[model samples]
Target chain A: MRTILSVLLGVIAVTTAPPALAALNVFACEPEWGALVTELGGDKVSVYVATTGRQDPHQIQARPSLIAQARKADLTVCTGAELEIGWMPMVERSAANARIQPGAPGAFEAASHVRLLEIPARLDRAEGDIHASGNPHIQTDPRNILTVAKPLSDKLAELDPANAAYYDNRHADFVHRWTQALQRWQAEAAPLKGVPVAVQHKSWVYFFDWTGLREIVALEPKPGIPPSSGYLAQVLEQVRREPVKMVIRAAYEDPRPSEFLSEQAKIPAVELPFTVGGTDGAGDLFSLYDDTLHRLLEALGHDSSKP
Target chain B: MNTTRFVIAACAAIGALSCPGTGFAASDQELKEIQQQIQALKSEYEEKIKSLEARLEAAEQAARAAEAKAAAAQTGVAAATPPPAPPPPAQPVAPAAAGAFNPAISAVLLGTFGQFSRNPDKARIPGFELGPDAGAGERGFSLNESEVDLAANIDQALYGSLVIALQPDNTVNVEEGYLQTTSLPWGFTVKAGRFFSGIGYLNEQHIHAWDFVDAPLPYRALLNTQYGDDGGQVRWLAPTDWFLEFGGEAFRGDAFPAANGPGHGKGAGSLFVHSGGDIGESSSWLAGLSYLQTRAGDRVTGADVFSGRDHIGIASLVYKWAPQGNPTQRNLILTGEFFHGLEEGTFDGNRFDQWRDGWYLQGVYQFMPRWRIGFRHDELDSDRLAGVFAGGTLDNLGHVPRRNTALLEFDTSEFARFRLQYTRDDADLTTDDEVLLTYNVTYGPHGAHRF
Candidate 1:
């Protein structure tokens, strides 16, 4: 009986003990949010990013490591226009963490801070996979980042009140640098304004809205559906009639469809780093837009305006 | 002289009363003053009108600018950080008010067309006493049980879900009804009411989430397809870098393996531990061990009845791989489970003691999007009983039951799937070759599946 009692005590001690670090732990669902938290929290917090920039944000599995990280998280940051609907709910339930459940102080949804685009006028499965709340790919626009940053910083401070001032200062600095970068990108991408382009997927709607680019056609027949050769034929005909300058696709997307169109219609196939760490040039949040603009301008056959 | 004076007076009177086309009423200097005054008044009125028009233009421009700003705000195009104490952010567009409080509802539809080389009624594992819910499904075209689920947050701290299975024979069963705590501290969660036991890897998953059309032979013989009962479960997720979980459950034992027992007190209990981690960005694996103990007063299996104490243990392993953590293109999943069972008691008024074991290994490979092929192998062994149990229900018949199955599946989308499966069964003395085509589709808001 004494040995059994000692065994129980040892198990309890091992399970109940917390990590040694004093920093607040955060779990981010996507790479962009991870980068943002790192920039704002700096050394005050430890961030665990669930998915990489090359991963599809819409389709993620609730892997075991993600649940473990969520169990230790003081806060969870996710793009929550049902973007993480496929796996986030499962991870939260499995983690058994009381702090990060929805409607809790530790839960922060970036989509709630910004207005969503492409809200469907009608809801139906016939339209393929649709987000009734709107398109969840909000990170393609830099301005949405500015909007999500404020609420995120406030949430960080609210969860870790000891570093409220520190969080605020870091957030203010990010805003200053981000606003300047946005202006530079705008100036560099002026030639891309109204430049008609065909896209492999609707993943770049936010980017098009920011750069004033017009979408002539999409390679996919519908959202989340891969295009067959027949559908590509139709898309090619449409682009030919509309006479677009280039075809665009994300770095993570399959290159086949866009390449096929580019070959059929004598146009360049441009691949943009959709998020941070998607490419060598997009190493951080700032360079994400810088690399994106440089790629778009390069496709237009113009020299990059900046180093 | 008097006439001339009268005429002059008349002319002066006429001029004062009415001047018609005559240059006799005013002087040139007075005319010039009137013209200059009229020009000055017209210019003053023109200047006032111009100022009013300019003000209207400025007001219109200001209104247009304000509208543009509102449009930008609606789309979240604010270039600067929102001011402190900004207006509460507008929530994602909510469902219609009428359904705001409604629980999430989903329904699963399943149908199967099965063909067999031998009579399915004569099907038996020879050595194993099949549970009531075990054995082959209905022959020919038939609609299997349709499951409807409703889940909602009971409160800030609890979540509740109910699943009802509708059988084709006009019967309904409550498959699962449980309430779970969502706000438990220290990585602990509690579930109460009727629920599937969390002992095995696939026990808690619903039929719609299965990789194959039917449960494996081991599951059928050992767990009666699946083990679920009125129970309370407690699980703890350890705070570690790897996924480690420990759970225990106590059941009233009104369902299978243990039946005809008192309605109160624990008739069966189980303990389980699971650990898992990712190999890298592309590979992940989970392993688990479980033990279940049951005290049966009167257990009925097929036409035979037995009262005994049963001990069962299970071990499961699962591995999954997707290139670069992206499964939309291609992936593979491999799963295996082993079960060991021991029973001792009276069967048909005779003392009986027997041991049984089974194992199954399966792998599914998605070579391309929406297409998958899978293969599974199962084998079961039993210890031949002696004396009164020989040639009885506990008899092994000196045979080792084995089966092989292969399947092909096509998923039209995330919500619908169609599968074709072929199984060669050698469980009985005669081999049975079976073919089945099945369709599974879901409607409404289905919750995300667990890994």
Candidate 2:
């Protein structure tokens, strides 16, 4: 019993010991939020991302590693609106960290900063997985990123007051560069305006809204449901009548459905990096949009090098 | 041109009339004088108009130069300085409706159809006493322990959950009801109220979350399927990159394995430690060690009664693998547990002391989306009893009981599943072959799946 007690005490001492560096620890639920925090916080914050860009944010399991990371976090950044309703709550409950609880200064939810799209008028299970708080895929729109950056930077400053000016300056730099990038993209993607397209999932509402693209048909019969062959056939029939320019899907989505639609319609199939680090070209927030626009332009037979 | 000619003739006539009744030659001379005078006057006025136009042009040029200078200064300022940083907009989105703070309530419905090669009513594991919750389903169609769960954040600092099980026999059981600290500092949490003890790895997991249709043989025999009691628990998680947790529980001892009539004073206690970490991006593992100590006073099961002190030790390991750390498509899970129990004191008025052991290994593989196949093997052995304790529940009967089970499962979505399971058992008095078809569905708020 004495040995057991001594060992436990040793573990407590080791675990509770403060680190040499006084950086604020941030736990980001998804890779996009992680990249955004890094862009704003720079060297003042240490970040742990719970899921990769290739993983579905909505379907992540509450892995133990996530809980361990959350236990040490000073702030938690996530896209709320129930996108992570399945697991983030469990991680927060198990972490036992007072600093990152909901309604605390250290908790930053990006969805609250901007108007969300596609709030369900009616709630029903038969409609497939739906978020009552609206579509949580707000990161698809670059304008929403700008909107979230201010509050997230404020949150960082709130948590680590010593680095407040640093975060503020970084946030200003990001906004300047992001605004210029948005302008350049608008000019480069002029030909894509009002282009008709097909999508495998409804995750690209914000993306379509940003680029002025028209959604012709979705391969999935409903949100979050994998497409059935019969449903795909109906979509193909619709595409035959409408003749969309291409079929688009996120980098993380399964390719089979969109590939089939592309084959049947004889249109180009475009895979876009939906978030930061989703593809090799999408190494940061800027390149994420750059690569996405590049793929969409390339599908339209425009020389990507010119843009 | 005509109008100009008419105006010149009219001016000449007017000049002629001014010299009334004069000669034609005299009129011509007078017109010449008048024209000369008009020419001189026109020249003076034209010169003045020219001077005036020059002054006006100078003023316009000066105004244009000043405007050009101002425009250049504005462009220069814009180039030299960046725009001022804009403040984050006030939340343009109205916060989502502050709906009533209602708990997330969900229900799981489980229905099963069972077929047995032998009479399930006569089922009994040799040398073991089964709890009321043990054994497989009786014959044909039956509703399993369907559950209704309610969970919510009580406040900023506390969380609470309740789960009630509805048995097919029209009995309602409180499977779990607990309040837990959410804002505790230093990776510590406190839980109070009736709860499943945090001993073995699988004990705390609800039945609806179980990977299989039923518990393993060791769990059934040693833990009475699952052990829950009125208790308070404290768990401390290590602040490390690796997942490490230590927890202990003190129970009121009115539940299974503890039997009845312990008269309070913490009739049972358990301590457990678990550690886990990821291996690269494709795999992760968790391992744990747990110990439980309790007293059983006049515990009775099917004419076999005992009064004794019980001690149980368990070691469990679970490893999961997915391609690129994504489990949506294909994945594999390998899990196993070892249990050892020691009992002392009197059994049916005989001095009884014995130690027994059991273990099981299970693996489930998801070959494709929504499809899975799994297999498990369970075995138990004991120290043989003799003399007065012979033929009793503790008697080994010179047999090492074992069982093997296989199952195939399909998930239509995250909220629904269908499974077909088959088992060959020798743990009971007579070897039995069991086959079961079950469907499980959950609706309302989705539940979290813990790894």
Candidate 3:
């Protein structure tokens, strides 16, 4: 009995003890921001990622632990072009943390720093799932990541003044390395320019812009809607007329649609690592681009090695 | 005009005289002709200048009118149509003010086809009295409870949500409507209006989120189809790495287990505490303890009417396991709850004391993506007594009541689900078997369910 009592007491002590305070606590709505925070803040910040690389950011289930983390967070970073419209508002309301509320300094949005794409000419719900603000998937291009990192680092420094110098230095180093990588990737991906591709969804506009790939058509009749038989037939007919090289989809998207198109069009179906940790080779932001370009190059029958 | 011509002719004659004898001087007739020519030229120049000025004035007037018309058209277009799309590079980051004011609205449609070996005559738990709301659903193809939800943030400090359920009989029921504080300090939140009490783990969840077709026996018998009442609640979250929370509620005691009491007072109340944390990368667990108390005034049970105090206690635990990266592909969850209660009251003019308890354990596993299977076991225990009831007993308590259930479910997408469930219940004198097929579809913006 005495031994059991001691064990119970020890367990209680361990659970009740407060965790060691880090310089800053960040709550990230997606894995990409979590990785970005780690890159910029290093050991000065501790991050909690709300959604994994494999989960769609548009919808997520709420958990009490997420609320607990948000309540104590000093900063909340997210893709704020309505990507998290389903759950983020409820989380903010439930957390009751003034620091992370809308219009507060602690709330940082990645989409705010970069120029968005696909702003609709008209606003209407009948057009299927469309973002009024524009496409929220800005992390597909590494250049957008650099654009976001500078402002995010500044926000982190403002939130944690003691680590201002640390954040500034990290931001500089990241920018220098990212610029060099962009130049190299552009040179290596020259063969991919003007390659015609069909996409499962309209989520890769930024990526195609950077690589100079042309989107021939899409599997979905409209954004965020599944394809119908009639739409699939139309796509197949277009494929016959056009020089379609491959079909591409994000790792999180269902692969069946793209696979169906590939079988009919006789093109390779390639799944790109849309974010960090989406695939084995795409462990970080740098490798995510590397793997994306390499797979597209390989699909086009070009050697993936440096020329 | 005559004076101008004379001056011209005189100048011409002076010019002829000054050139002395080298050329012939102008004659009178010649000078007169020169004067007439000068006069014609002067009139032509004046008419041309007048026409040019008039043309310039008309052009300026037309340009001014065109400018006004263009300015009016720009404003008219803005007023008549929606705002033009802003430039993509310079789009504002601020959230859409119009969309923010509109509450999130969603609807869920549920339909089921069921078959039973025996008729379900107000399904009872053998030893416990039931309320009017405790009836099992109808057999054959039936429209089950459909729900419409509306939720919105009222302001910076308050949020509100409402759920209205539509029964198969076309009766509308307000399942929940409450306003909660969002900006309370010290991890404190307060809620007011009608809501389900936080007395048990499963009580707060809606029917659409249930893993099984029907609720556990304890919920039907002890709480009379789950405890929902007009009330107020306060909750506090502890500042620690572990998930620790404490909450309490005070409600009007007009629901089951406390009927015919003062309806407008704080006659019913409960307290609960829960704690949870991740065990590792792929597993998590939560445990909770809850207590409820109510005053019963002429509460009816079977053929007897009782009046006294009742106390109930509940303990629950939930465990979840998933692979390291994704839960959609594979996961398993184990949930269990135990309920115990004591009632001390007068039954049909005779004083009696009774003790009852019930428990259920269930497990659900997603063996593959979009497919899941689940199993549940239920049992109830009650004290057996002879000659304690002046009227009559509902059933012999010598045998313990038990139930078993199995279910298979498939999800077409995040917004739709299909499930088939089979249950064998031995809660009464005879055993009963039931099979149920259900489909649920959701539309519009639905908020995520809490885990």
Candidate 1 error regions (>4 Å): A1-22, B1-96, B263-266
User: Which candidate comes out best when scored by TM-score?
Assistant: 1
Query: What are the per-residue Cα lDDT tens digits for candidate 3 across A241-275?
Result: 99589999888777788898899989999998888
The DockQ value obtained for model 1 is: 0.32
Report the lDDT tens digits of candidate 2 across residue range A1-307: 9998899779767876766575888999888899999999887888888888787788787888888899999899999999888898888888889888888887889988877789899999888888987889999988888889988998888878888999999999998888888777766766888999999888989877777899988887888878878989999999999999999988778888999988888999998888887889998888888888888888998885354
lDDT of each candidate versus the true structure: 0.85, 0.85, 0.81
Q: What is the full ranking by DockQ, best candidate first? A: 1, 3, 2
**In model 3, what lDDT does residue B364 have?**
94
Clash pairs, candidate 2, are: none
TM-score of decoy 2: 0.86
Please give the distance, in angstroms, between residue B139's alpha carbon in candidate 2 and its true position after superposition: 1.2
**Model 2 misplaced regions, further than 4 Å:** A1-22, A305-307, B1-99, B264-266
List TM-scores for all candidates, in order: 0.87, 0.86, 0.79
**Cand. 1 Cα-lDDT:** 0.85
For residues B1-451, could you state the per-residue lDDT of candidate 1 as single tens digits?
5335444544554563487467666556655654555456557668988999999999999999998988778557434543222223456556677567899898999999999898887788877888888877768999988999998888889989999999888799999999999889999999999999998888888988989988888788878889999989999998888888899999988777777657434388999999999998899999999998887776777678888777889999999998888887788999999999898888887877788899999999999878999999999998998787777767878988898999999987878999999999898878999999999999786358467
Candidate 3 C-alpha lDDT tens digits along B168-245: 999998989999987788888899999988878889888888888788888887788688888899988766566777
Off by over 4 Å in 3: A1-21, A54-59, A93-96, A118-133, A162-166, A198-202, A216-243, A252-269, A304-307, B1-90, B93-99, B261-266, B301-303, B367-370, B390-396
The alpha-carbon RMSD over the true interface for every model, in angstroms, is: 4.7, 3.9, 7.0
